[model samples]
Target: MPDSGLEGLLRELSPQVLGALVRRYGHFDLAEDATQEALLAAAAQWPGEGLPDNPRAWLITVASRRLTDLLRAEQARRRREDTVVQWTLPEEHLAPAADRLAADSDDTLILLFLCCHPSLSPASQIALTLRAVGGLTTAEIARAFLVPESTMTRRISRAKTGIKTSGVPFGMPPEADRAARLDAVLHVLYLIFNEGYASTSGPDLVRSELSAEAIRLARIVHRLLPDDSEVTGLLALMLLTDARRPARTAPDGTPVPMSEQDRSRWNSEYIAEGVALLSEALPHGPTGQFQIQAAIAALHDEAPRAEETDWPQIEALYELLLRLSDNPVVSLNHAVAVGMARGAREGLAALEKLDDRISGDHRFHAARAHLLEMAGEGAEAVESYVEAARRATGLPHQRYLHGRAARLRES
Candidate 1:
């Protein structure tokens, strides 16, 4: 197999391998490290040797051996230091042979639940989920977040340590807590996708790798929980939103607002998939925020052109979303939809209601600026645009806001 194909195969299997090791061995940090080593070995050897008949089992076997070695080494170190380790390794005789590990037993979802443990911060949760479940290298995750590789390494290390200290078992959370835990998992994925789609603080408008990883992870969750309306909705939302990526930027990387983008460039496949998923999700139960958001995205995706966007429906969906979560960002977006569906003044009125909550946010200023422009208040619009530019952290966002101000000044 080619290196790329081999690489993808290894990434897909690495988490399963790690999940199996951790589930049996009860050492997450070591098991994760061992899984990475196993992946490295596969990368080195798989190109020379043909793919294994059971590639997942092959990785699990390799990783389990590596984990055992690591565990014994740690035990020896504790012995030398005259300090007893708190946990004892399970009897080797009782453990199942790696090659004979049950093919039907997958702990990947459990692994994801562990990575999103409540003890970890949101940033750490995102980093750890990408590492453990998404099978990304630490350096690759670092580059995606635009952090130094060393910093990312530390974040992941700390996240692992946090999980260990929390003493969370290597299984699903209690049935009582499972729903909340799943929400955390979904939230982490949502954050990852949002960062990729619209980087909070970066030179680039979109980090395709991060977004793609988020989508990949979302698909995994959706597959695992096919009946989960929110899971399906989240996946649908990502697909619908990412469908615009092809037309999101210009040759020079300047972001083209959706209204100005050429609709023909959007990914129809993503749109169709997203629409289908949303259709399947909406009627299942009471609508959640993700489903509502997906419904709004489907409206945008189904539109033939920007001019045909169902803004009234989108505004209604946003309103539904706001009732579910008191998110100022949602309110800001709601203001935009109001402006589009009703009028600039009405949108401005809606935005004003969020002043107390998100007045300082660059998004608020940016939206206000746009509405001001639409209201024929170019001077105020230019001021708001300049403020937004000043407050914006991402270079692309800054450039866009400044350019808006400059255009209005010239006009």
Candidate 2:
């Protein structure tokens, strides 16, 4: 009765069962609900009763029965007896779920594409992705974004309706529509990874499990679309950045800044692999934002010491990044690089330009505080640090910022 084993198997089974129901029934909403119920039944019954011989078939039969029952009830209420389809439930169960379902099934990929359908807005796409594809509960997704459960529920409902109304197929999207859909998919994946990389609201600074899950998903996407430069770039960026995971926190799980991290602890193997990935993607010629960011990270990985970092090149790459993406987050990081390459004054000036959009962000205040500190504006730095600590969501970061503010005030 290994809990982790059961949970992992259930997670894998969810998409396939849900996808099969969706494909057969053509009712994504109903199929999703039924699949969840089937999973719930398994969770309750499997541990005590023991694993069934055919876990997937058991799930499918149960979920299909549930779906059929619902449809039958609706049809009965509507007096549409002609449309009612009868299905018999399987009485059997599993022996240890199969080792990986059919690879060519494309069920997961289709589910992902539908979740990120262009008909839905980015926020809606994210909500759907987290719920349907990421296997997150509605409450968990709501907590992650600090949105109301009712609101997220509506958002997910609306997204599904949009997909239905837009006639989004439950199969691979056409080539002409794929680029845009894939962008949304990548964004969702990155968002998931970023949450795992640095949770917005949590006691722990790094949600290691979540980050690792993100990487696993990224590998899935890379495997599916091997030739796409952006795919390689995305994987490379994640690997390059995640290579520093071991040194990101202290033994007590306290946050550690990049500058103070132990270089020896950084995974050299991940760095080499990431470097190879970025190198391959780059020669294909600047595919997108991920590649450029990977390049910047590669430069840092190549540097032997903090003082030896090629700040000038990093600064230039950030500038190029700003051109490609007008994202305020990019601006914030670019300003930090500018500060390092040039000076606190130049960095502060660049940061000032982003105050309109980024002023309220905790990272903005923290970055501004650091720059002010370097510029010898101790009082201003302390004030900014205090604000950052106040606004910060992650407890680990809040503690770090508070400590910083205190030291600056004492000095």
Candidate 3:
């Protein structure tokens, strides 16, 4: 294989290989180091020898060897108890095809659990998971959080140190602790998808890469815990939302409201999958926030035209969501449905009640602006759009707000 192809293969295979390595070594730091060394070895060898049939397996073998060498060297230097023995592959385990899929799946889940270790702050867990598990660059993670690259780097480093010092186990948490940790894991995955669905601060309106990563994570979580209703709901929500990605932006990267977006452009396959998942999730007795949100998205997807939308059903779903999760965001979203179902004035009134609670959120202002525009309060609408644009973090969103305000001003 050519050098470029080999490099590409290495990049693609690194995550799985590293996950396995971490499982073997019982430390993220060691897994990362060993994976890097394996890549270097591959760079020197694969070009001359050709790509291996099983690239991931090949990388795992090389990384395992590299880890053993490092541990032996460390033991000699410190005269300390040898930790390398733990990483040594047994002769019985040498064949990569043997339990490869099962091992990889377990490793990936374990890596996620490690990233969500309770000792680190939630922000650090998200930042680290985005960087490590999602394979996002530090710059991308930093942009998502509106932080400096250096600061994100420090946060990731601290997170790694925290994991090491806290002696957090690498594999899946026990059944008792799984419920408690599930929220953090789900929240991290949600944030990843949201960043991908609508980039917070980049030139592009949609970061498909990030969105794809999030969807992949959600699917993995669903597979790992198939009976977990919230996991199923999250998968359904993401699929439903992702189905409309093609119609969510203009060719120029401007925002396209759902009412104006072309339904024909939406991915029917994803919509079907989302609908099926939602059906499966609904029978689980009680619904969670994700399930309610998925129901709302499904309501929109089921409509052939904007006027045909079941606004009352959507309003009811949002109301249920608000009940399940008393978040200001939920209330604000519910207000949009109320406005569409009842009238702009009703929506405006509902939004106004949320002002004191969600004044700092730009979306709250943007929603109010849209409602006011529909209400013919052009001046107030323009002011609200201006405020939303001022507080907006992403370039595309800010531009969209400005354009909306400018159009209203001209009218």
Candidate 4:
């Protein structure tokens, strides 16, 4: 890891380094605090001091020192005179990066298990993973989720405190528990990718860093747990989505509607890999939500043009997906597919059913606007477009929405 790009460097090593510290100290909460302090210290020092030959080792040494200080403070409060002075860990344990090849696999896996502990709620698991494993600050995670920084701060704090009480052991779990914990891990990774792929609310349409990091972590999972079908499915989904990165937006940061994106510019390499992975995942049997979603993305990628998309198959897949996931967003997408497969009126009717449930969602209004335009109700469509623009949070979405209304008005 080069010292010049410390942010990305720290993010990449966060899980591995933090894992080592937590495992050595047997204090997840304290280790996380110390790791964060180490990162902050590095941010301030490494630039002026020059990059260390072994950056990970430097971080481990720094965080371990912090952890030792914390332990000494706690021991002083207890007035334990003998143990406080005697407390010491093996020096080799503090310098984990010296033997990373030996520790990487187990340490990273254990860190993930702790971050995705079953006792934590799904929200907490995602927050903790981003903060601890993903090396995202509480503020960045808050922005990703469209929540206030204060709220996110409390949420992460609660998660850390709750886990301390949960009494989870470090390292591997029993076979039965492994499956459930890994499920949470996959969910957090997908959420991170989705935020980066299509930002929830921000000036930019995409945050490539988050998506790229998610892909890196997913690849790690795929490498270690090759037999896990959902792992393959998720990696495929992310790659397929990421393949469109080059064409997803225009030069000015406005989103290029899916129909307008140039397929020639799409990342063929990622698409090829995604296609191969999806093929492998399908044979594993029992298609999951991730598999179904990946299959849908594969269909679109398989097409040469928007007109060539298999709408009926996509509609069918969306229907199956909605059955598996009672998510309102899935229902909204199903309605979009219905419009394309059936007619604008049919799509409008389907979308209208979800209006009450998804009224506040910009996509709900945007879909209605598109359907209305297709139905030749330009005036109504213009109104819908404006409404969608008003509700839209992403700058690109807002630009596209307002542009749609402007075009409709001109016509």
The 0-to-1 C-alpha lDDT of every candidate, in the order given, reads 0.88, 0.83, 0.82, 0.85
Q: What would the TM-score be for candidate 3 when compared with the true structure?
A: 0.85
Ranking by TM-score: 1, 3, 4, 2
Q: What tens digits encode model 4's per-residue C-alpha lDDT throughout 1-411?
A: 355577878877777778887766666777888888988998888888878899888888888888878876766765655544443443535544422444435677677788888788878888888788778889988887778999999999999888778877667778888887788889888988988999878789998878987898899788878888999999999999899999999898988887889999999999999999999998996888999999999999889999999999999999999878888899999999999999999999998788466878889999999999999999999999999999998888999899999999999
Stretches of model 3 off by over 4 angstroms after superposition? 1-16, 39-57, 76-105, 136-150
Shift in Å, residue 6, candidate 1: 1.3
Of 3 and 4, the candidate ranking higher by lDDT: 4
RMSD of 2: 5.2
The residue pairs in collision within model 1 are: none
Between which residue pairs do clashes occur in model 3?
A: none
Query: Which scores higher on lDDT, 1 or 3?
Result: 1
lDDT of 2: 0.83
Ranking by lDDT: 1, 4, 2, 3
Error of 3 at 302 (Å): 1.9
| Candidate 3 lDDT over residue span 254-274, tens digit each | 999999999999999999999
User: Which ranges in model 1 have alpha carbons more than 4 Å from their true place?
Assistant: 86-105
- In model 4, the Cα lDDT at residue 120 comes to 84
The TM-scores of all predictions, comma-separated, are: 0.96, 0.81, 0.85, 0.83
Q: Quote the positional error of residue 299 for candidate 1 in Å.
A: 1.0
Worst 10 residues of 3 by lDDT: 90-99
RMSD of each: 1.7, 5.2, 4.1, 4.3
